[model samples]
Target: MTFTDVLRYTAFSSDPEGGNPAGVVLDATALDAAAMLRIAADLGYSETAFLTPRPDGGDGPGGRGFGVRYFSPKAEVPFCGHATVAAAIAVAERTGPGDLVFVTSVGEVPVTVARTADGRLRATLTSVPPKVEDIDPADLAEALAALDWAAADLDPALPPRIAFAGARHLVLGAGTRARLADLAYDFGRLEALMLRLDLTTLQLVHRVGATDFDVRDPFPVGGVVEDPATGAAAAAFGAYARELGLVDADADSVLTLRQGVDMGRPGVLTVELRAGDPRIRVSGEGTAIPTT
Candidate 1:
């Protein structure tokens, strides 16, 4: 028999029921990939975090470093932002909020946890260097068809592209909030397309204000119909927006992403881009979910 301590946390919201929930394992030194996958599948969240302390006593006080792995119910993912936040907060609750370094499949990620003015813990993760690529016309058409969205329903300004920070996400900008809402996509179709493209999610967004937007992610590849609050997609969208000059790319700017509203689990994600840096910063609050 194998014993594993799994912690439940909701990231990107102060309310436990209002954010994306993730399973977090603080110490997974003894678990292998099969075990981790089984644990994640059992939890049935979009992604779960598994952490093993760095053998070298890597960084931060008392060598606050870990080798973090993210797993969806069906498979392992390169990186997961919300899970990272949950894991960071899980550690901070025990060791006090501070800086920590995580060696992920994508790269080394630096995270900072601090207490907010309202006395809530907030975690911010800096993403790996990101890049944006234009999607093939046929692929874009297929994706739109799967989502039941026509070209006219898309925002001509944002354009479609695949963006990668820690993970690859297809970014599609909706022309209107109504278009962004009413998400009814073909699961198998989207999953097949995502698998072919090696995509983690489809970032469907609608720009409300200059720096404010509503976003949704279709994560069929992760065995989840939809992701309530997606930090990875948010990071990728930030990179795409910057590259397209949708936001100020030459200066520091912060963008607000409102997600999960249509799903009734509303959550907010803050994305920051600094001048002269290709990396994106995603920040959100996480709370532990009381288990019975």
Candidate 2:
């Protein structure tokens, strides 16, 4: 089997200590599914992205793009924001800064990379069409039970729902920021429920201000307790806010998401919403992690 050099990077935050780390295989045309899974398992990151050149003149019907796939150690995911950012930067390192379209399992995602003033790389990914759905009360109860959290621990304002961008996630808002910090849960039970629900992660959040939120993600299905930062969830949250009419669509709205603070790896994600665009823009700085 052919093996390509993979780069490790954390996206959505400047500090290496922040953001979610993803394995980036910029070129994987020669690798198959089993090889990709093995690589992801060996890297042991939350997700790994494998990029292959699209067949000549096969970039969608009229779009000129490449195909990309994301894989966890256990299984393949439809899309992964952190892995997308890492792959964008990886491509930019060789191809220079510009637009790159990725054909994902869910849909096509357009990512743009630009060099920042401090000589850092910033990647912005415009998500596919997002949708939100009301979660069943019984499922919410089951989830709460799995997490060992009571109804009183949940924030009444935000409510709970299953939100989807490229993937599905259960959004749970905590009554207080402190409650969000304490995150001991039944790993096996939560993992089973998440698998049964086809959920990617549990987007646990706490509203600190009208435009600011602190978030955490429980990714038992991916064999991880918590993701440092999640861009897909941030995009889905933007859609959820728009669907709920929490922000004016005609105005430029920006939401700041603070994640990974409880895990000692703090990350900040900026979610942007434009009036005419249905796609959410998730942008953040990424840093390369040297492979040993």
Candidate 3:
């Protein structure tokens, strides 16, 4: 199996200057788990997606799409939103834009790719059934301790919770934009706690307005200090807001997430929630980064 078959692309934001970049292995049928891990490690991206043909008669559309697995340098994640978008566009480039289903460790995710009015391909992924719950006070305290932050630093409006869309994340809201901008954290300590909790990332956010927010993620468990832009977290956050009645559920709502500014790589994520639809829709544009 040659590694050349794998493709690389950035997702969520279009400029390559913005958005998260993920590695895509559209056909990983011949590669074992170890090989995939090795490739992910070599790529050194936050997450790399590996695709393998699903067995016939599974709960997907003819398996035209494959069973997808996501791996960071250090561990396997249940699912990754940015990588899924990257992989969807990669597949669309090869198989044409349409509906594709990915059987993931958490659940089945359906993604659709369509050409935008500006002639760019955009992918929208509907998250698996989502759930949100309150975070334990002790756990929240531990998280705050690891970040060297106090309860006062938290945003009272957004609160904190553990949310799941295809993966688990602890959603934390900073009290002010300055608090969000300051991101010094104990990486090793946070990683240990996150491993115990099976958390993929800590979704730290600061709301700029009712519909606009700035976000950041500390993904130490994934062997990264931070993710440039996180799609899965965005989906989970949408669910969190709906579950908390932070946003009205009767109207079609769109939320804008700005991330990665501190790291110098900025990204934008558009999250849509339709009334009466339980699923969250995440849409973004991706551009290929030219390799040296």
lDDT by candidate, in order shown: 0.93, 0.87, 0.89
Over 1-292, each residue of candidate 3 has an lDDT whose tens digit, in order, gives: 2533767799987787678889998778888889989999999999999987764544365235678899999978999999999998888877788888888898888898899999888999999989998878888899999999989999998889999999899999999999988999999999999998888999999989998999999999999999999999999999988888878989889999998889988988999999999899999988777776
Off by over 4 Å in 1: 1-3, 60-63
**Shift in Å, residue 117, candidate 3:** 1.0
Clashes of 2: 0
Better of 1 and 2 by TM-score: 1
Pick by lDDT: 1 or 3, better one: 1
On a 0 to 100 scale, what is the lDDT of residue 53 in model 2?
80
* Residue 230 Cα positional deviation in candidate 2, in Å, after optimal superposition: 0.8
Candidate 1 structure lDDT: 0.93
All candidates: TM-score: 0.97, 0.95, 0.96
Residue 108, candidate 3: C-alpha displacement in angstroms: 0.9
Q: How do these models rank on lDDT, best leading?
A: 1, 3, 2
